[model samples]
Target chain A: MLLQILNIVGIVAFAASGALVGVRKQLDVFGICVVGATTGIGGGILRDLLLGVHPPDSLSKWPNITASVATSLVVFFAHPVLDRIWSAVVLFDALGMGLFAAGGATVALQHGSGALGGVLIGATAAIGGGVIRDMLVNEVPLLLQRDLYALPALLGALLVVVCESIDLPQGISLIAGTAAATGLRCLALWQRWQLPRARVKD
Target chain B: MLLQILNIVGIVAFAASGALVGVRKQLDVFGICVVGATTGIGGGILRDLLLGVHPPDSLSKWPNITASVATSLVVFFAHPVLDRIWSAVVLFDALGMGLFAAGGATVALQHGSGALGGVLIGATAAIGGGVIRDMLVNEVPLLLQRDLYALPALLGALLVVVCESIDLPQGISLIAGTAAATGLRCLALWQRWQLPRARVKD
Candidate 1:
């Protein structure tokens, strides 16, 4: 039940982000919906594909589709209201990222992926939707260029793996993992932390 | 046997195209290889996921990876030589598109997809890789903006559906479908055929 609630929250947050980008890009209604749906479920789809799970959970479960579509419509119609609360949106996005990273790691581990594989898959799940959304808008993915984004997800996934390895209870491990990711992301934002970039000669 | 050979040919062509793009983008060796592999197999991966086929064929088969990596390396080192034969590359790309479209439609039908579903999946398989490659390099997919690119693949997929509906022999249907796509693509190139676009007001 908790997992389901978290998943819905993440889907709504991600879908809103995608819709915002679509509106900014002046995409058609169809394009906006496409981007929103992709952002909401693209990561889960990627994780499932990597784990060789066919007919991904997102497609099989009707609720996910509903949540994403509903969020898209809301964003399309209420951009004026939603756009003003940019900080709130960012907070929700960070929370969603943390939840997704933990969820993805758990799924990967359940499917027999190793610790490293779990971490990679988790990070991919956390960031894959954003990457796809950015690509649709013809922008570089923030995951690739932004500092401290992928790292938090990776660390969160690693925490799950370590906790599981030590036979910790599932619920507790999940909460801890999610908290670690969310906290780290918030800290990075507050500190304006950035990853180093290579210096190229002009 | 024939399908395997066709798949390899398509992989090589797509990989080369991806590598060429990476080189043009001035990406490093790792980025070049990443783009080449994504372009070579991303379509098949998408098709398989949609069809509920897990652990896509490309990941299971070593040859696909080898072909993409080898092509990436060759393009990185011998770009000047490859660049001089642009016509040859274009021809091979057209052939690959035809084969992949036909193959994707066949797979979808075999997996119990309806005619419309087959057509959609087929075109996706033919064009998904290039879309992904372009996105990785932060460019809008030509599939969306370019007129003739996706049309040929869609028509080829439709042909496959039509042929199977009439109970045409499998071999004949595949051949005819592939030929239709390849011929149309080549003609489009020769005649500079284009689809109409919406004119924006200045």
Candidate 2:
């Protein structure tokens, strides 16, 4: 029941984030929904594909699709209201990322994916959506940018793997992983942390 | 034996096209290989995922991976020579696209995908790779642009569907589909065909 709730909220939050980007880029309503849905479920789709899940859970679940589409519609119409609560939305987005990373790692581990595959698939699930969204708009993905986005997700995945290695309780690991990733992301946002870049002329 | 030959050639041709794009972007050798391999096998991977084929054929097949990587290395070293025969490369790329489209449709049909599913999956196979390569490089995918790329692929897929509905020989359908798609693409190149776009002032 708790996992179901988190899935719904994560889908909505990610859909809202993609909808915001689509609106900023001046996409049509259909285009906005496409981007929003892709962002909401694309990662899970990739993870499922890699792990050999047929039909993919996200694609087969009507409620998940409906939630993402409805959230995109709400975002499209409620931009002015959303603007006021932008910080809260950002927080939710961070929480969504943490949940996805940890959740993906747990899924892969349960599927008998190796330790390396668990962490890699976990990170892929966290950032794949945003990378795809940026690609659609012809912008550099924040993953390769200075943002400390990927690192937190990786840390969360790695932590989950560690828990599994030590036979720790699944619930304990999941909660801790989410907290670790979300905390690091919020701190980076607050401190304006950035990775160093090479000083080469393009 | 003939199908194997075509698969090898198709992978190499697509890899070369991707490698050329990576070269123009001035990516490192590793990055170039990554882009090339994605372009070569990404479409197949997407098609397999959509069709619920586990372990995607591209990932499991070592020869396919080796061939694409070797072709990327060749493109990286022999770019100047490749530039002189760029027209030839474009021709082969078109042929590869056609083969992938028709071949993908046949596979889907065999898998019991309906007529619509077959065509859509086939087009997905034809364009999925380039979309992914562009995504990795942070470029707008060519599919959304004015290029006459997707229509020909769709046409090929449609032809395959038609043949299947009429119970035609597989060999005839495959050849006819490939010829139609490649012919249209070549003609478009010669005439510089483009899709009309909405002119909204940004």
TM-scores of all candidate predictions against the true structure? 0.62, 0.60
Q: What DockQ does every candidate get? A: 0.15, 0.14
Q: Compared with the true structure, what per-residue lDDT tens digits does model 1 show for residues A112-172?
A: 9999998899888888888877787787776766578888989988898899999998887
Separate clash counts for every candidate = 0, 0
Candidate 2 Cα errors over 4 Å, as ranges: A84-92, A165-169, A195-202, B1-42, B49-130, B133-138, B142-202
Q: Among these predicted structures, which one has the highest DockQ?
A: 1
| Candidate 2 lDDT by residue in tens digits, B34-134 | 99998988888888888898788899989888988998999888887754554754665687788888887887788776776677678778878777877
State residue A29's C-alpha deviation in candidate 1, in Å: 1.3
Give the poorly placed runs of model 1, Cα more than 4 Å off: A59-61, A85-89, A195-202, B1-42, B49-106, B112-127, B136-138, B142-202
Docking class of 1: incorrect
In angstroms, the error of model 1 at A126 is 1.3
Q: What is the C-alpha RMSD of each candidate to the true structure, in Å?
A: 7.0, 6.8
Angstrom error at residue B10, model 2: 13
TM-score of chain A of each: 0.91, 0.91
Q: State each model's CA lDDT, in order.
A: 0.78, 0.77
